[model samples]
Target: MSKKNKNALGGARQILDMNAFDAGAEATERNPLLERRLANVGAATVLFYKEPLEIVSASGSWMTAADGKRYLDFYNNVPSVGHTHPRVVAAVTDQIARLNINTRYLNSVVDLYLDALKATFPAPLSNVVLSCSGSEANDLAVRIAAAASGGTGIIVSENAYHGNTSIISEISPSALKRGNLPDHVVTVPAPSHPGQSGSIENAFAADVKRAIAELERRGHKFSAFVCDSIFSSDGVYADPPGFLRKAISEVRKAGGLYIADEVQPGFARTGDAFWGFARHDVTPDIVTMGKPMGNGFPMAGLVTRPELLERFCEDTGYFSTFGGNPVAAAAGMAVLDVIADEQLQSNALRQGNHIQERLRDLATKDDRIADVRGAGLFLGIELSQPGEKDQPNAELASSVINGLKDRGVLIGAAGRFGNTLKVRPPLSLSQDEADIFVDRLADALAASA
Candidate 1:
């Protein structure tokens, strides 16, 4: 780590114990929202939906909650670059102080922004349409996919979660709003170990083939096969991108589109490549992005082949008041620049290697930690029973998460049973910070045992 990173890590370490002095009766009373939020989350039995002690501010890879407590943040995959990164903040601020408006008129920021973004994708997938969030981008993707394929059925992973919009929710098996049992949606199991032995890549391809075959048997036309290329919710599986090649080929043969949802795993969080789909060595028909693209400035977009999007334009126009405006473009541009200039992608590669090594060692020591899987920055620590077939233990997972929070580190959990601890920190996290995080996580694991 550089001297700057060393100092920043030291500063975060210093504030870890500050909450000890005042995290008491007065603090709880003053923030009634913090207290009541847990009750609401508990009433619903929702996973990690509570207010979470009201973090007052955040910068880089650390967040300072209400009680003057600072915690190392390893859960915010959306802050792809970093929290309140000075360059991104300045870019947005400078643009807003000058001029920011719709795309009805030509703007340098929007044009320059699109140019930089287009360089990240394959040549055929060059055009871009911006939106304010991943949900909105996914919504636009649905319109484009439906238009391009002339089909209504969409295929997704069994526990996949695309977004919260009605169309996305219908396809996302994780959505509890309407039970996610939509008529036009086809769900298939995601690729993971400990389930089937022979090449999970083959299993994924078979699943896609089976889904398409079933759709054909039922005389149903499929619009698209949508998947998070990294599949964060399906236990952070990032192997065998070539595994989906046959499935995608089948989808295309069936006149369906292949949509890679990169909302949580975009912008080089997966390391090795800018888009998670690139890791698979397959170019997607349509790609949706959000979360880290703006580094928390509410900017996202759908990029696709001009030919694919043209079908939608022929029918109805897609427009959002806040999409691709100057401010959003500026933030997005800054994030891209930081990823290149700061070499944050390389940093994610190195730090993720370190984290994975440590976690793997921990898993060997304790059989409860079923597995550790993911590609750079995005990771999942699976919790299971002792010497058993990695069954989901949601209770133990929650205990470890709350325990880590108490120790001044934050992480997110996903998977169908909410039993995997998702550890996707900011891409800018340093080696020193990684050490602190690993130490604390080990402490949490010991406490759980």
Candidate 2:
């Protein structure tokens, strides 16, 4: 084949082999359930593992598969509190039985939930707009920013995955399957420090400033700079507190609003702060939250300054039929109660520190384990080729992820090169659970080796 054809085939192979769970595994047997799912579900639906685990039930930090085996979950951040906490279950059940209605009517439950949610944010972020999912919240945030700033340009990380909405997908460079970024959207490199020295903060700020200038050159006025506060999809970079201050300032100076997408790192998962942006001490103009909002309930929302919200409302009247319904409010409230009552945040801090300490020790012995960095429970372990530091070894990462699954532990990968193990577990993970995770991770590394 010609060189160009060979390169095209290599690219196709890379995409096909991107599944972290398919490495070092035997050929999948034909399962009847798998066949049924394939027939019904779209081709875009991705499943974990070459042989997918049929998870039947879950609790706390463990899930029971159809094979009657329990796996320690380190992949799911959606269950922020835990998998089906009794309080959340009871709250949803009770609210459904009592009354479930939209926010159009006067509802005491919604009011109480709103009050509790607002208390978590800074005073200026008093206005809230509830939505059904992170995608909707992000979509609305973009709209609000555009309306408030009268600008159409947006800035995002190179591999950011903000949401799945059409507008959001355009800005989410990771979601773009083909073609360059849209004219109105510009992407900056994620805040990552591999080998390059100097301040990552200043570097990031410079990138933001350049993106804003480029947007202006193209006659697209800057509207917003949106990012996953923890840089989750860009491989979970949460270090050097206050690193984001410079970039946020650049966005504000460029007359663009800062929208913090807290879908992955919110709700005390970071342990250091309730929201990931809080760790950087940067107050976003609009904060979009989801995934862990209701401890797995289909709930998300955006918190913003009252003036911006008022301007958005004036531009386009906003109403969500099922956004802040009584049931969702009840579930959200229950999640908050569980977070405080169970002291999950403190537990996350303690366990996360322990895990990172153990992993750092392991890294000293393992050449392939390039870097172990994160804040609280949101962590990433970068894999590299043996003896070649900083050279991402995506194949090794895939092998380790699949190996962990075979050993009854669940995990995933992230980053532009897909070589960073994304280790985000439930906030309620116990010390014992952390020990299990570290042990399994060590074994998985060995297996990969």
Candidate number of the best TM-score:
2
TM-score, predicted candidate 1 vs. hidden true structure: 0.89
Q: Residue by residue across 1-449, what tens digits does model 2's lDDT show?
A: 24574343332222223562342356557678866776687465567877888899999999999989999999989988999899999999999999998898999999999999999999999999999999999999999999999999999987888888888888877666667778999888888752243788888898889999999999999999998888988888998888999999999988999999999999999999999999999899999999999988899999999999989888699888999999999999999999999999998898999999999999989999888889999999988889776567877888888889888899888877778899999999988999999999899888778
Clashes of 2: 0
Residue 103 local lDDT, model 2:
90
Runs of candidate 1 exceeding 4 Å displacement: 1-30, 35-51, 177-180, 193-197
Which pairs of residues clash in candidate 2, taking residues 3 or more apart in a chain or in different chains? none
| Estimated TM-score for each candidate | 0.89, 0.94
Which ten contiguous residues of candidate 2 have the minimum total lDDT? 8-17
Best by lDDT, which number?
2
Give the per-residue lDDT digits (tens) of candidate 1, residues 2-110: 4574343231111112112222324433556644654575543322323345678999999997789999999888777889999999999999999988888789999
